[model samples]
Target: MTFSDVVEAVKSLSTDEKIEIQLLLQQYLREERREEIYQNFRAAQAELENGSLKFSSNIDELRKLIQE
Candidate 1:
């Protein structure tokens, strides 16, 4: 089904059901975000181990690195 179809179905739900669905969606989004963060952390760790990542002690150094 399309997004519009899903929207119409949600609109037909009772108030309580809508609230439950909202909570479930929030939980699912949070879990997705957490997993994304974990994956990013693992990638950064691997880059560091391979000597391909640089560490900066200040904003100036970070800016310089980004410019390159």
Candidate 2:
């Protein structure tokens, strides 16, 4: 089966079933986003430990770092 087939099957679902699927998809998306944020946090920690990460409070300094 392909994406179109899955879409067609969803189209055939009753209103309640469609609502349930939408809720489930929203939950799945939230979990995926949470995992992505966790991964990014871990990567940033590693970068900090390796002494490659930069931090600044001044806007001019931040702009120079970003340009590099």
Candidate 3:
């Protein structure tokens, strides 16, 4: 439930159990991060397809043009 409870429970497990739990947690975290990255990529792709993305060729040139 809480971090302290998790730690206490882990402390009671055998070495093999601890290792198995650690691996399972690591895999779960990896999958979560991968899904987050994929969602970001999909959103960017949609923005590009819908013409909602913009870019400037030259920062200095753009600034000069804007100042005029």
Highest-lDDT candidate: 2
Task: Using TM-score, give the best candidate's number.
Answer: 2
Each candidate's clash count: 0, 0, 0
Model 2 Cα lDDT, one tens digit per residue, 1-68: 99999999999999999999999999999999999999999999998999989999999999999999
**Each prediction's TM-score against the native?**
0.90, 0.91, 0.73
Order of the predicted models by lDDT, top scorer first: 2, 1, 3
lDDT of 1 by residue, 1-68 (tens): 99999999999999999999999999999999999999999999999999989988999999999998
- Native-to-model Cα distance after best TM-score fit, residue 61 in candidate 1, in Å: 2.4
Would you list the C-alpha lDDT of every candidate in the order shown?
Answer: 0.98, 0.99, 0.91
Better structure of 2 and 3 per TM-score: 2
Decreasing TM-score order of the candidates: 2, 1, 3
* Residue ranges of candidate 3 with Cα displaced over 4 Å: 56-68
* Residue 44 accuracy (lDDT) in model 2: 95
TM-score of 2: 0.91
